[model samples]
Target: MNLAILDGGTHYHREAIYGDRYRSRFDRAIYAPDLVLADLEDVGLLIVPDRIDPVLLRRHRALLDDFLRRGRTLVVLGGNEAETWVPGVDWAFRPLNYWWWLDKDAVPVQQLVTPEHELFRHLPFADTIWHFHGILLPPTGAKALITVPGDPGNGDLGGALIYEDCVTTPGRLIISTLDPFYHHGSHFMPAATRFLDGFLNWARHIS
Candidate 1:
C-alpha cells in the first residue's frame, strides 16, 4: 500500500516524527494547503496527524470524501476537531490528567474493547494508555477498539479512545484521541514512541 501523511507545517514535532524517523516508509508528505484530490489519488493509507488546522480539512472536505469513496484508508490521530471534518464523529474535550500515573494505585484509564483486533498484534494495550485529550462517542456500526470508562468526578464522561469505521464510508477510518507523535517527537514520552513503532508498522501491513 502507498502510505502518505498530511503535514500541516505548523509544528516541528510532525517533521521530527514523520520526516526524520519514518521518512523512508512513507510515499509522500503533502502539505495541508496543497491537499487536492490528485495528491491522494495513489495513496492507499493517509495519516492525518495531530495539531493540523481544522480549517484546511474543512476546505477539502469534498476531496476527502471522494478519496474515501475510492476505497482508501484514513488514519486520524489526536486533536478535538474531528467532528468538524470527519463524518459521523462526535468528539468531546475532557480535562487532561497528566499526573494520573503518579498515584500509587492508579490503573490505566483506557480499556481494550477489542482485544482480538489485529492492531493489538503490533501494539499492546498497555502502550495505548497515555492520557487522552478528548473522547469519541462512536457512531453506529463503528467498532471501538479502546475505551475509557466514565468517571464523573474527573468530568470524564468516558467514550471511545480509538475506533474503526467501515460502515460510514466505502473506505476504512481509524481514529484515535491519542497524540503519540507529538509526545514522541518531543522526546518526553517513551510510550508514545512505542505506540508509533507499533502503529506505523501496523498501518503499513494492514489488510
Candidate 2:
C-alpha cells in the first residue's frame, strides 16, 4: 500500500521521524495551499502526525473528508484539536503528568480494552503506556481500543486513548492521543521508539 505523511514543516520532530528515519517508507505531502486531493490520489494511507497546525487542518477539512470518502485510511496522532477538523471526533484536554511513573504504587492510566485486536500483535500494550495529552470521546460504533478508566468523583467519564472508527466514513480512522512521534523523534522515551517500531510495521501492511 502507498503511504504518505502530512508534513506541517514547522516541527523538527516531524523532520527527524518522517523525513530522516522513515523517508523510504512514506511520501511527503507538505502542508500548504497546494496540498490537494491530487497529492493524495494514490496514497492508501495518510498519516497526520502530532503537532500539525490545527488551523491548517481546519482549512483543508473538506479535503480530508473527501479522502476518507474515497475509501482511504487516515491515522491521526496526538496534541491537536481534532474535533475542529475531523468529523465525529471530540477531544478533551487533560493536564500532563510526566512523572506519573514516579509513584511506586501508581497504576497505568492506559488500558488495552481490546487485547485481542491485531494491533496488539505488532505493538504490545506495554509499549503504549506513555502519558496522553488528552482523551477522545469517540462517536457511537467506534471501538475504543484502549481506554482510561473514569474518575467518578471528579465526574470525569474517562475516554479512549486509542480508538478505531470504521463507522464515521467509508474508510477507516485510527486515532490516538499518544504522541509517540514527538517523543521518539526527540531522542527520549524508549517506549515511544518501541511504539513506532511496531506501529509503522503494522501500518505498512494494513489493508
**How do the residues 1-207 of candidate 1 rate in per-residue lDDT, one tens digit apiece?**
688888877555465446567777677888888878788877999988877788888888888878888899989988738888888889877789988988999988788989999999999888898788889989899999999788789776678999999999999999998988777767777888788888988988863
- Taking all chains together, each candidate's TM-score versus the true structure is 0.92, 0.92
lDDT of 2: 0.83
**Among all windows of ten consecutive residues in candidate 1, which has the lowest summed lDDT?**
10-19
Q: What is the lDDT of residue 149 in candidate 1?
A: 84
TM-score, cand. 1: 0.92
lDDT of each: 0.83, 0.83
TM-score, candidate number 2 = 0.92
On the 0 to 100 scale, the lDDT of residue 23 in model 2 is: 63
Lowest-sum lDDT 10-residue window in model 2: 10-19
Candidate 1 runs further than 4 Å off: 17-19, 151-157
lDDT of 2 by residue, 1-207 (tens): 578777767565555555666666665555654588789888889888887778888999999999899989999999767888888999887888998988999999788889988888898889999778989998999999999877889998899999999998998999999888788777788888889878887887774
Q: For model 1, what is the C-alpha lDDT against the true structure?
A: 0.83
